[model samples]
Target: MPTLLTVDIGGTNCRFARFSIEKGALTLAGTARRQTADIPDTQALMDACAEALIAPGEADALVIGMAGPIAGQRRARLTNAPLELDLSDAETRYGVGACLLVNDFLAEACACLTPIGAGAFPVLGPRDAATGDGTIGIIGAGTGLGTASLVRDSRGAWLPLPAEGGHAAFPFTGKEEADFQAFAASALGLSYLRGDDVLTGRGLCLLHAFLTGERREAAEVAAQGLSRETETLRWYARFYGRACRDWALSTLCTGGLFITGGIARRNPLVMRCASFRESFYDSPQRSLLERLPVRRYADEASGLWGSAWLAARLIGALPA
Candidate 1:
């Protein structure tokens, strides 16, 4: 059996796990989690992970799914968090045989390719039998908005395609939407607003202030269940649905659209609301959207599993 160390580094928390691979299957061996704020930088984060999860030389490989853009095969810079990682340095500092870094959503997308277990629930449309030849799309809101795709290659292996589509210009459907865009642009001192400006955890607070001239943390607003807060969540869900619909149409994702992130998982009512499905199916491609299966992934440890899967593949322990 081969052992692989996997880490999911996010803005709020960092999760680490060790997996044992045998006969192309991965079994969770040990796991630990810590607040990213407590560990200021990547070096410290990796050191803490190794201390909590495994001995320095026990793992064969290290795979990290980080909440940021991967500049090259060896380096990644997290977006919301103050951390930059060089996988090359990790190999020396952690005593791992190999290290791989990828965008966090790419790991989430990889998880969609495998059996997701029971951490997923339907949100819109009926579950359709995937033809196994089309694309699978994923969109979620956490510390930031994330997007990715899974497509089959010529060899029939599913390939993870990571994207920073979250920073794309947010779509505006009406004057109210346009007003929000202008407000966000002026507030952020940008010419235009990106999706993350209005769809993330911080974005929720911003939206609340825009709507009611009030400032509250995302969690506080969510807990209050006030009319204004409810309105904010509905707006968030609607935009999220639109984002998902756009990705689905662009990728022709006949497989399914899987929603995973801290926000959606924590607020099941908002996901199940009619506002979400209404906006998702409001497109001109109504027939296509209706046939698409949409689900909210409930598991927080999904990225860890995904990183392990990639590690197993990289080590040739799993078939492509």
Candidate 2:
């Protein structure tokens, strides 16, 4: 059996896990988490985490799922974070045979292709039994909006496709949405506000201020749990559902739509709101979307799990 090191790095925190592969099965051995701010740079963070989590040279390979766009093949940089990853540096620093870096949402999408446990729950349309055969779509809202898809290759293996769909222009549904867009444009000092401008954690704060003329942190607004914030939450859900539907339609993700990230996972009520489903099954695309299964990626460790799976495949412990 070979052991692999898996890392899921986000804006606020980073999660590390060790997985042991035996007989084509991956098992979680140990896990640790640390705050991202506690480290100075990517190398320092990885070094500290690796030292704390695993015995030197114990890991056969390493896979890192990081927030933001991944640049370069052998060397990658996270768009929103101040870290750069070079595979050669990582292999030497971590004492691993090989290392791979990928977009965090791509890892989440990979998780969707695996067998989900009880952590996942239905938040929208009925669960479809045939979800295993087709494409899967994923969108998450946290520090930013993340989007990705999983499509089966000719060999019937699911491959993750990562994209920067979050930067796409925010769609406007009506006059109210247009008005809100105007407000976002002026407030953010931009001619165009992308999906991240209105679908992320900071976006929620912007929404609260725009609707109530009272600025409040996203966490504070969520904690208030007041009726005044219901409309804002609904708006968020609506936009979220709209984005999911668009992705579903674009990718023909009949397998399902999985919503992950801090906002959706921490605040499940927003996803359960009627507005969310309404926007998801909105008229024109209702026929297509209604048949697709939808589930929230409730497990916080999904990215880590996904990374482990990728590592197992890379090591030939699992069929590709």
Residue-wise lDDT of candidate 1 within 16-115, one digit each (tens)? 9899976667888888999878877666866787689885457887888998889786788779988777766666666778778999998998886555
Relative to the true structure, how large is the alpha-carbon lDDT of every model?
0.80, 0.78
Error of 2 at 82 (Å): 2.1
> TM-score of each candidate?
0.93, 0.93
lDDT of 2 by residue, 73-139 (tens): 3455665556666665655665768678888888888886555423577876666454577888888
- In model 2, which regions exceed 4 Å deviation? 115-118, 128-130, 225-229
TM-score of 1: 0.93
How far is 116's C-alpha from truth in model 2 (Å)?
3.3
State the RMSD for candidate 2: 2.1
